[model samples]
Target chain A: MTLEIVSPGLSTTIQDLGRPGYFHLGIPEGGAMDRLSLRAANLLVGNPEDAACLEAVFMGPEIRFGADMVVAVAGATMPMTLDGAAVDGWTSFEVKKGQTLKFGFLTEGARLYIAVAGGIDTPPDLGSRATYPIGALGGIEGRAVAAGDVLPVGQGTGKAGRTVAPELRRMPGRPAELRVLPGLYWHRITEAAQESFFADEWTVAAEADRMGYRFKGGRPLEFVEREQPFGAGADPSNIVDGCYSYGSIQVPGGTEPIVLHRDAVSGGGYFTLGAVISADMDLIGQLQPNTPVRFVRVDMEEALAARRDQVAMLDKIRGALA
Target chain B: MAEIQAPVPGTFYHRPAPDQDPYKAAGDAVAAGETIGLVEVMKTFIEVKAEAAGTFKGYVADNESPVTAGAVLAEIDA
Candidate 1:
């Protein structure tokens, strides 16, 4: 019926598929960073695919449930325990009233998802319960869950013990590669810099979060010389402040590249070199600081194919559980 | 002999900020849950807290150096 937070983790918030159709109003979609994982967690607990779940980053919370409930954890590998007993992730399990859940150190990935049967019963704002802390929209009062805050839970419809197996999903790569679709503002950057964009190995910067991930460890890219246009900033990387697609890469000051995510700003003036393919956003969401990354260019056909493959993977998970 | 590990990987900071004194020095008594350092990633600096009461051992990872998950950051004489 309710969950009591004994300790709030680093950054735990409620998220779902997010609210689209509002980007024109300067509101980000602001869903779970890794939607696939959110879906997987919901599936394990028999909740609807978009049922809002808790997105815990780095550290996870210590939670006590007020009633018996089914639960599942997916995405990052933060060791979890149910009343001191080890709890396996990617698998569903049940807990009795007054039982507590704790998370240990993270051995892999950046964000972790915890899904309860039914869902986190919070009122929606603009059709979503996903939190965008920057604007104080959605989630519990539009912020991360705090200690002693009681969260309501809906009724559970699924059983426990089933697992989500997406081939354990991209945890072992030393320098993960993100497949990219280039040419958003490709003509704006010099040919040499564009080459390096795909060839050079970039490191995830410490400034990364749900809004965007900035990468370092590469030379500042040079943009092609052009007369400054009206309303565009004086910087060469500036544009006319255009729409930013989710996963779009924008370089400001041409110093570092940022890939927007679920909580992406609707429009920006910076020049975008490319976008991480839709299928590859999950991999980007898992990047940790100092993690090496390389961008590989792909055509639109390949991008669509990759997305289809991901959908097939979800169907695969559903079949295995069934 | 127990050592404090980095819960998550990032650049390990020995002090709260660049100008502040180091949170702990070797031989200092450390209390449980006391923050001794921070691991900064993606603009978020997560405090590294002492897990048990012990005599602090000097940092293992150099200040501002990149650390991997589970990598020893400092030692504690329990």
Candidate 2:
């Protein structure tokens, strides 16, 4: 079976759980921004939780199915339709041959996940179907979907009408709260700045995408006076190039703070005050431009607990869908 | 009256750039699919187009203001 793209959305790409263990080689763990949503969509379509799905941002592609297939959409709040008939999201539905799927304007959230029963059958690079466009690795030709691109689908036995309950969904707040663990170059900034970072409400900037999310409208960070270290630039926010973990919050020029995402560079020169906890990383993917956010401080123990809670939430989803 | 709604959430712009004149002003004739404004979302600027030919009634939303999807950006007299 295959899916033919009639029109590519704003930024549609195939993504799975992502390929890990390549960060040391300067390659990030590029994958779906909303990992939970991807997994949910996959399970609804009876595919492996990590099976490749289409991740569309802001808008969704117009796709024509070449054969009958079970499909599900998760993440974001974009209304979808099948052959001009309105379809409910977070639920699986069957599409017949020649049937087309399209989407309406996104009313909430930034990304949406569309999962097929057999998954997108693209050849995986480094054991992943996730697209890393910056590195030109993975997905179909390592890029976003284009018109007339026919994507292969693996064999599957998924059924239709499987719905993910409302309470089971992870809904982001109006002004989302991201729990951060201060580390790395935290000492480089003054105490006043550190306090202000958590105290001030920051607005998501227009530059948010798969690579990173930039937040503006926060108070400018003031750096502590210190002799410039070798290899580090004169900017107070500059540091000797260091590894950037997923969710690393880097503030360049101490003006706007950017949270590195799945496709972000492995290392950079900007100073990272801390990282948004892993549990909250997926929430960042759903935030829209101008969305206000606050950085809530958390300790290592709290971070670990939050991670366990995330795992539990996944377990609940699996059990409900099983 | 025909309404021009924002397709995505972002900062809406009346001009192509900060220094340029707006794409349309009050009482300007607008053609269907004509670019009336821009909505900058995820660093991508999408042209807000008029859905039907009409007389421009001016922008309802302020320039560079943050807007939500479905928020009326401008109106036109059909």
Candidate 3:
């Protein structure tokens, strides 16, 4: 079976958990920024959590299914319809051949996840179907899906389940309190700045993307001259080009904070003052432009526990699917 | 003298292929924007392009060495 892309949205690409352990090769771990939503959609369709899904940013494309298939939509709550009939978000539904799927305005969040049973069939590079747009690797031709692009769907046993409950659907929109952990350079900032980081509210700046989401917050942080030195024996500069892991909080020029996402560069020169706990990255992905956000510090042990809890929850959902 | 640092943190490679000559050696005339080395991260090899045009001086870090962000990989005589 196959799906024909009628209208590729702002940015639509195939993604999975991501390609890991190759940072030393200069490849960023490109994948779904909001992995939780992706997993949820996959589970709804009885697919593996890491199955390739369509990640639509800002808007989504119109697609025509080639055969009867089960599909689920998650992540951003965009207005979507199948054959001009309104469909529920975050639930699995069977679509027959020749039915057209159309996505409308984004009601909540910045991106959407569309998972189909059997997953999106594309050549795996470095053991991942996720697309790295900057380097042009993975996914279909290692690029964003475009109009007229025909995506192949792998063969499945044709066994599928029912839809998810409406209440179980992810709450659309960004959350207020954002959890973070101290990073390598957390001590570089003065205690006053650190306090302000948690005290003052920040807004998602216009310069937000998969690479990093810049935030406009309180007064710019000022660091000692020696703390901003470069080269050997010098403190790493607060500005450089590189993709950081999801949740990395950068304090460039000791001013605004930028939260790095999945498609972030492998490394950079910026001083990472903090990192949003991995469990909280899904909330970061849902942040809307100009949305106010506050950072809440948490200990490493707490972060670890939260991560475990998240993994367990995903496992429970998967077990239910079986 | 200015140094050419790794654009991104990764393993610094002197040559593209093993058993191949280094892209540039000490005292070689190199121009700006010339790729002097490469950094491999996540199975992706990114070429490190020289920002300043000058004579290639020496490498600060050895081949196949793990380097972090801003780590100077090579020096050039400007």
Candidate 4:
């Protein structure tokens, strides 16, 4: 079976859980921004949680299914329609052969997932079907799907009518609060600047995408008056090129703060103030441009506890779906 | 009556560029799918298109002002 692209939506790409253990080679673990939604879409269609699915931003693709299949969409709040008839999201539904899927203007959030029963059968690059467009790896031709492109699908059976509970579905908060753990470079800036970072409300900028999110409207961070270290640039925000963990919050030139996401570069010259906890990283993806946000500081213990809660929540979802 | 809504949220631009003329002006004939303006979201500019052939009424949103999804940017007499 195959899926034919009618009109590829704005920035639609195939993504799975992503390929880990490759960031050391400068390849980010590129995958779905809202992973929970991806997983929910997959499970609702009887596919594995890591199955490859379409991740569309702002809009959704117009697709004509080549064969009968089951599908589900999750994440964001765009209304889905099949063959001009309305269909519910976060619930699995059947699509007859030759039926087309489309979406209306997004009502909320920034990205959404469309999971087919057997998952996309594209050849895996680096053992992953996830697309890393920057590195030209994985997905169909390592790029976003274009008009007239046919995507092969693996064989599998899925039962329709499965739905993820509303309470179980993850959504970003109003003025989302991202918990951060201050890093080793925290001392580079004045304590007052650090306090301002958490106190001042920052808004997501127009520069947000899969790689990272840029936040503005916060107090400009002031670096301590110290001589630049060897190999570091005169800009106080510049460091001696250190490794960047996923979710690292790098404020270049102490200006707008940027939170690196799944597709982040492994290392950079900018000093990182800290990272958004893994538990809260998914929320970053759903944040819309100009959305107000606040940085909440957390200790290692709190971060771990948050992560554990996230895992437990996933377990609850699996149980509910099963 | 026809409305051209912003497909996504961002800063609405009435002109193609800061110094250029607006994509459409009041009373101008707008063809279906004709570019009306642009919405700059995530550092990318997406053209807002008129959905029906008509005479352009005027922009509803101000130039370079923030707009939300589905907010009407321009109106047209279909």
Relative to the true structure, how large is the alpha-carbon lDDT of every model? 0.88, 0.93, 0.78, 0.91
Query: Which docking class does model 1 fall in?
Result: medium
lDDT of 4 at A303: 100
Which one wins by lDDT: 2 or 3?
2
Q: Which is the leading candidate under DockQ?
A: 4
Query: Tens digits of per-residue lDDT for model 4 on B1-78?
Result: 898899888889999989999998899999998898999887799999888999999999999888888898999998
Q: Model 3, range A1-322, lDDT digits (tens) per residue?
A: 9999998865689999899978777787778988888988888887788999999865678999998898888887777899999898877788999999997666567678999989998999999999998888888888999989999997654344455555444442343577889877777777887788888888776567778778886777756455334442343345444446667888866778888887777677777887999887877777655567888889999999989977876666566566
Question: For residues B6-64, what per-residue lDDT tens digits would candidate 3 score against the true structure?
Answer: 64444689998898999998899988899999976434577888888999998899998
**Alpha-carbon RMSD of each model:** 1.6, 1.2, 15.8, 0.9
- Prediction 3 TM-score vs. true: 0.75
The ten-residue window of minimal lDDT in model 3 chain A covers A227-236
lDDT of 4 by residue, A47-157 (tens): 999999999888888999999999999999998899999999989999999999999988888888999999999999998999998899988888999999899998877
The list of candidate 4 runs beyond 4 A from truth reads none
Q: TM-score of model 3, chain A?
A: 0.91
lDDT at position A169, candidate 2 = 84
lDDT, model 2, position A248: 91
Number of the top lDDT candidate = 2
Model 3 alpha-carbon drift over 4 Å, by segment: A158-161, A165-175, A225-245, B1-78
- Provide the lowest-lDDT 10-residue window in model 1 chain B: B41-50
lDDT of 2 by residue, A81-184 (tens): 99999999999999999999999888888889999999999999999999999888888889998999999999988999998988878957978999999987
Tens digit of per-residue lDDT, candidate 1, span A1-322: 9888899887889999999888989998889888888988999999899999999887788999999999999998888899999989999999999999999888888889999998999999999999998889999889999999899999888899998765944452768888889866989999899888888989998888899998988878988999999999999999888988899999899888999988888887988888999888987777788889988899999999999998998888777776
